[model samples]
Structure formats: structure tokens, C-alpha cells
Target: MVANRTRRLSVRNISVVILVLVVIYALVGFVGLPWWLERVLPERLEKHMGWQAEVGDIHVNPFVMSVEVLDLDAEDSDGEPVVAFDRFYTNLGVWRLVTGVVGLQNIELEEPYIRLDLLEDYSVNFARDWQANNPPAEDAPADDSDSAEPMRLQFDRFRVAGGELLFRDFSQEAQEDFRVTPLDLALNDLATWPREDSESNYYLLAAVGSQTIEWEGDLSIAPIYSRGFIKLGGVTHTTLQHFLKPYLPYQLRDGRVTLSTRYELQSADELFLTTSDGQLDIENLGLGLAGHDDELLTADRIRVGDISFGLNSRNVSTGTLDTDGVNLSLYRDADGAINLLEPFRNEADEEPADDSSDTDMPFRWTVAGVELGNSSVNWRDEQPRTGADLSLTDLSISVDELSDQLEEPVNYKADATLGGGGRVVINGQATPAPFTLEAGIAGSDIVLAQFGAYINEAANLDVRDGSLSVDGNLDLDQQQDPLTGTFSGAGEIASLDLRLGDSDERLIGWQTLRLEPIEYNVAPARLEIGTVTLAGPTVNVVRGGDGLH
Candidate 1:
């Protein structure tokens, strides 16, 4: 009877111990772990990073070794949110620890936002003070043989969605601000240790202002190699104007650029980059003179197609370059200097030799073809006493091919209207290496009265109304000491009315005058005329007592 009573007491004691263990497991897994994650973790984070941290809720599943954090926020001393996230979820592979590897099934972040501020001294906001307070630790001598290898890390999947990054620069006077929002990124099967599975498939997409940037392909971190495609669309120049403001004399009023290319990068021995099958487009470009209201240039679009570039080879090639609706403005001030060239005037002083030239490889580039349509140039000359304005409209130019290392001549053609009264056309072939050009030029109905200022200054004569026509061929050779050119032409001047020094009376009048089979050379300054024909000519000369006019 005593033995039976002892046996019952032992069984009761075992039941009590099992019940207590169940209670402890329930409390820690369902309650205590969540509380520590939500409260203690944030406190420790704030203490280490000098930032206030807040977590809305945390959920932990001890059995699965998984964690989920919701509405986490970290703010700087100024109460500015430096980092925030809506949700973070990760699951650890606890069994993998036995194999000396840290493994995660998946890691995900949603609605993560980060703000970065750059100061005038080129320091970032969060790092400025922290780095100053905590200098890098001194390196200690160690024997490599005694060192233990770092633990390997692996993840089946990692993802970020609805991410935003804001970058503000106080270095510029204008305080440039840029933001990338709606950033979505994904990487699959990533591992720190080198293996056949180390090459991860990655994709990134983001919106930068109104633009969209995308990158996708395979990447390996251990060997540092990537092969992918990158596309940038509608990247506005206004967003990046701060980078050019310090170096350019003009203001970038407006523009957008787009580029798409396939790229490969390798960093095993030396860094190398290559891109192929690229296309670039620029649209609605406008440039204006600094501190002036006048626009220097404007273009509707420029496109380059079939581009290939290599960084290590220092080579660039494009199949075609095309442009449309371009306009250029030029002005000559009263001082006989062009306003558009004011910034470059009197720059005869030799420039300092660039040190980089000694270390840098020479670049080689080529363009298969070029086309420009609907372009115009407007020129205003205040040097003329009366101020003259001239316009070249309906201008179109074409080039067959051009390159820095061309052995054959490149063919080109151009056509335009001058001052709404004359038509000009030129066809040429040029070789850049030898610097030679052979061109055929033709012009008709060129009003001579438009050049009255130059005519009056050169010969003390005024031209009221006249028209000139010419057909010619010119060959130029820069190899010559004086940059000589040869011209063979036939020309005619018709309906010319000339006067002397503001006089009302006509000094000379001609119905038609012609010079045929003319040959001119610039170097030796020679002119040969085969025939001179005058249809009707009249001259009025008065011998005044004061002077002979």
C-alpha cells in the first residue's frame, strides 16, 4: 500500500513539470519574443546609431524562426526621417547553422524610404558626425594562417518594393534636390561564397522624377562580374543642371535624354566595361546665354542609333546621327566682335598641358552617317551702322560618313535659303586626316543691297538694288602654308544701281554684266577671266572743284 502511494506521487510530479514547460514555451514564443523585438531592439538601435527608433508591431514564430516587423521608423536629431519602412519580413534556416553556413529562405522589405543630405563640404548628413566621433580602428598585424575564414551567407530570394530615396545637395547655391521613387528590386539565389549558384538573377526598376530607369540581368558578387541591360528614359536635363552649372558659361534651359544599351562588366584583374546595341535620344533642348535673355540654341530632337562603346579599348562607333528642327542664333556687337563668341575671344594664350593626357589612352570614334533637317541660323550684326539682320532658313545637311581615322573622302551636301531672297546649295567631299575639301557651290538671286554696309566701307559706294548669280567649284588644302583654295566659276551681276557716298544721283548703273570661265587661286592671289560681257552699262561722273568723284 505504501509503494502504490509513492508511485502515484511520482506520476503527479511528472505531470506538473510537463505542464510548466508548456506554459514557458507558450509565453516566450507567443508573447515575450514579440515584446523584446518591439521594445528592446529599438532601444538598442537608438543607443548605437544616434537616432530615434520606433517600431509599430513585431511578430515572431519561434517554431519557424521567422520574424515580421511593421512600421519601423528611424529619425535624426532634427526629427527628420532618415530611414523608414512599412514592413520587413525574413525567415532564418536554423538547420543550416549546423553546416557552418547562415541561410535565409527569403527577405523582403516594403515601402522603405531613405533620405540623404549632402553638405557644402562634401559630407553626408548622417555620416558627418558619426564618422568624426568614431575614427576607423587601426589595423593590427595578423598571421593569415591562424585566421579563421568568414562565415558564408546565402539567401534563396531577396526583394524590395515601393522604395524611395531622396538626395538633397546643399553644396550648390540653388540647393539641388533629386528623388527616386517606386523602386522595385529583386534578386534570386544569392550567396556570398563562390559557387556555381553564386550568379544571381537581378532586376531593378525605379522612377526618377518623370523618368524611368531599369536594369536587369545576371550578377556574381564573388568574382565581381555582371552582364545586363540598362535603360534610361526621359531623363530631364533640368534635374542634372547642377553638375554643369559650375563648368558651363551658358544655362541649360531644357532638355531630355534617353538611352538603352546592353552592357558587360568584369573586375577580376582590371576593371573593364563594354556596351553594345545602344541607342540615344535627346529632345527639346534649349541653351541660353548666361545673364542674357537671348537663346543661344534650340533643337527639337537628336538621335544616335546602333552605338558600340568600350571603356578599355577607348572606342566609340555609331551607325547614324540624325537631328531635326535645330535653330542657332548669332550676334555681332558694334565693336566688330561676335556676341556668341565673346567668351572665347582673345584666347590665344596657350593652355596648360593636361596631365591626364599622359596616362589616358587616345579615344577613337566614328559615325557611319549624319543627317540634319529643318535647321536655321539667324545672324544680327550691330557693327553695321544701320544694324543688319540675316537669316538662313530651310537648311538641310547630310553626310555619308565621318571618322577620326578615315582613309577615304566623306561626301556631304547642304542647301539653304539666304535672307529669304537667295538660294544656296553646296556639295562637297572631305578627308579629315589630310584636311582637304572639294566642293561645288551654286547661288541665285543674291540681293547685293543686303550687303550695303560692307560695300560702302570697301569702295565708298552705296548699292540700292542688285542681284547676283554664281556657279562654282572650290578645292581647299590645309596642307598649304597659307590654307589655299582654288575657285572656278561663272557669275553675273544684273540690275545694279550704285551711288557715291549717300548721293541721290546714281554714279553707275548696269543692266547686266557677266564673267564666264573664271579661275581664282587664293595662295598666289591670281584671277583669270575667259570672257567679260556687258549688256547695258551707264556711268555718271561729275568733276566737282573740291574733288573728283
Candidate 2:
């Protein structure tokens, strides 16, 4: 009878203990814990993160192992809001709580507005916050030490929807507003630990100005390595032109531009930028002086494709770049200035371009090849009375091994169809500093009338029935103390007739003229002649005018 009573009392006692424990758990998860945390979390977060943080209506759902915070607001010291969001939801794993560590499985945010501003002298508030949050690189010794370990944050996934971002640059005199609406970002399976099977991936989409940007790829957020493909759809050339009006020397009136890039990166003192394929396209682009309306140059189409490059500790390299459909006009104005290249000359007092190497940067680089195709160039000279037009069609350029700190020399080759039915071919090789070139110019027949402007510029003469040919080699070295160069060639001309610039009638004629092995050097301005031969030369004398002898 006593044994039976003991068993009954023990069962009743166990049931009472279980009921009390269940009540306590319910109160802590549903009301007590969330209320206490919401009251203190704002101040604690603000103090620890060095920013003002406010939280409203936090709810902890123990049954679902989840927490949701509604209406979170944060601001920086300058009273500018860092971020404002309608809702932030985080999912938790019960196993993590048992391990006494705060770990999140998924974090989702709704409708956040984030702003970034650039300040003067390259100082920015975003940079301060980034440095504050990131681990000190200086503290990590260069030597590999087991004792030192970087603190890593762990999270499974992160997502943001219906976001808006704004950026402003106040560093320069020209201030432009940049914004992206309906910005969305997502990442999944992110972790501090490196795992081969890690399916960490991300995607982003935003519209800034007229450009729509889309990015998708794999990423590792901690210890930072990422690979992504980006597509920038058709940016408006007019918008870019106005935005860049301040610093540019010429105005861009119209164009349609698109770009795409595939890249991989690794974060280190030495950056590794690995690109698989990249391309940029522009069509119907007009180039002109900044304030002038008349277009100085225009291109029907331009394409740069198949670009691949990488930079790392030892070297930098480019796979190949193909440039096509480049058409433009070059002109000399009445002031004897070539408009194509005149605007780029910088004054001596202005700051020079930056060529300083980062002491740790890789010194060697190679461009595997570059090709220019379907290029047509037109040059016109409008110097007072001399009106001349020159055209080069069927023009193509090729370069190979263009490199520094490499074993092979850089090679360049050009083939072009010249005006007056002439063809020119040139080939050269160099260490990229000092170079040598071999060239040839030949045609069965060339008209001197088409080269009238060159004659007037060189010898102040007008000519008819002119024919010219040259087979030459040249060597140049600008790296020398005073700059030295040499050119040697054999030249020939046939059926040439010339007259003084003031008179149109021919005064001199030659059936054939030849110069063999003529050489010249520029450091001391020396000329050496091997042989000069003239054939069937004739001169006509005018009675009342200046005549040829």
C-alpha cells in the first residue's frame, strides 16, 4: 500500500514542475524578454557601433525561433541618417542558442534608404565607419603566427528588397546628384569558414541615372573574394556629357554606350583583378569643342571587345583587345593648329599626371595583342589659301608583345592606303622606349595634284604628274640624354613637273630622279648622302618673270 502511494505522489510532483517550467518559458519568449531587450537595445547598440540606433516594436517568437524589429532608424554624428528601414527580420537556429553563441541563419530587410556622401580632401564619413568596423590590418603581423586570428562574423543569408540609395560628391566644384531607386541585393550561404561546397552567391540590380546595372555571381564576404559578371545597359551619352562638362576639354553631344564585364578579385595588399571577358560599345558619338555647337568629329560606330586583364604581385597581363569601326575627321584650323591633338597639351604650371608607382606594385606587364580594323581617317588643312584634303582608307594597325620587364620586344605594324593611289606599310620593334622601324611606300602611279598641299608646305611649289616611292629604315631612342634618332632610306620619283607657288605653269620637269642610301641623324643634325641620280631633267625660263635655272 505504501509503495503504490509513493509512485502516485511522484507522478503528480513531476507534472507540476513541468507546468511551471512551461509557463516561465512562455513569458520570457513572448513578452518579458522582448520588452526588456527593446528598452535597452537602442542605447547599447548606439554606444557600441558609434552611431545612433533606435528600435521600435521588437517581437521575439520562441515557437518559430525568430525575431522581427519594426521601424529601425540609425544616424551618424552629423545628424544624417545612416539608414532607415520599415522592418528587419532575423531567423535563428535553436542549436546556436544551445552553443551560447549569437548566430543568425537568415536576415531580411524591407524598404531601406541608404545615403553615401563624399567630402573634401578625399575624407568621407563612410570611410570612417568602414575603418571603425573592420579589423586593424596593422595589428595583423606580416609573419604567419598561429596565436593571432582574425575575428570573423558568421551568417547564412542576407537579403534587401525595395531599397533606395543616394550618393553625393562635394569634393569638387561641380556637385552632381546620383541616385538608385528600386535597388535590390541578395546573398545566400555566406560563412566565415572556407568550404569548397559553399554555394555562396549574390545578385544586385539597380538603376542609376539612365544606366541600368545588373550583377550576379559568387562571393565570399569574410576574408573577401568574389567573382561577378556585370551588365550596364545603354547609358545616355547626353547625361554623361553634361555631368562631365567641368573637367573635360571637349564636349560630347550624343552617343549610346553599353558595357559588360566579367571579373574575379581577391583582397590583399597586392590586388588580383582577373577578368574573363569585357566589352564596351558606343555608336553615333559626336565630339566637339565644349562651348561650340558645330561638331568637329563624329563616329558612326565603335567597338572594343574581347578584353581580358589581370594584375597581381608578380605581373600584369592583357589577353587581347579588338577595336573596330573607328571613323573620325581631323582638321587643321586657320591658326595653324591641329584640332585633333591640340587640346590635350597641359600647361607647365599645372599638376602633371600621376605616374608614380606604388612601391609594392608589379613592375611587369604584357598586352598580348591589339588590333584596329575598319578604320577610316580624313585630314584637312585649311591654312589660308592652301585647301587640302587627305584620306586614308583600308587602314589597319597591329601590335604584339607590347610589354615591359619582359623577355621579348614590343612589335608594331601598320598598313594603310594613302591618298593619290599610294600604299604604305611599316613595322617596328622596341623595348617600348627606344625602337627601330622598317617601312616602304610604293605605288604604280600617283598624282601630284592630289599632293598639292604637301608640296606647298614643304618646298613652296605646286606640281603636276608627281610620283614618289620610298623604302626605308629608322631608329629612334628618346631615352637618350638629348634625344637621338636616325633615318636612312632610298627614294625615287618619276614624271615630276613643278612650278612656283605664285605661278601655275610648269617650269621644271624630270623623267626620273633617284636618291640611294640617304641617311640623317637628329642629335647633331647630320645628313649623309650615298648617291643622287637625275634623269631627263629640263628647265624652262620665262622672259619677264622669275625663271628656273
Q: Highest TM-score, which number?
A: 1
* Tens-digit per-residue lDDT, 253-358, candidate 2: 7787888889998785656677757787877787887455666666666666665666554555556656665666788877788776666755546888897776
The sequence of per-residue lDDT tens digits that candidate 1 reaches over residues 201-319 is 89999998789999999887766888999999998878647777777766889899999999999888888999999999999998887677988899999999899999899899998
Tell me how far the alpha carbon of residue 183 in candidate 1 is from the true structure, in angstroms, after superposition: 1.9
- Candidate 1, residue 402: how far the Cα is off, in Å: 1.4
- Candidate 2 residue 467 C-alpha distance from true site, Å: 5.2
Worst 10 residues of 1 by lDDT: 128-137
Q: Which stretches of candidate 1 lie over 4 Å from their true place?
A: 1-26, 132-150, 247-249, 343-350, 353-361
Best by lDDT: 1
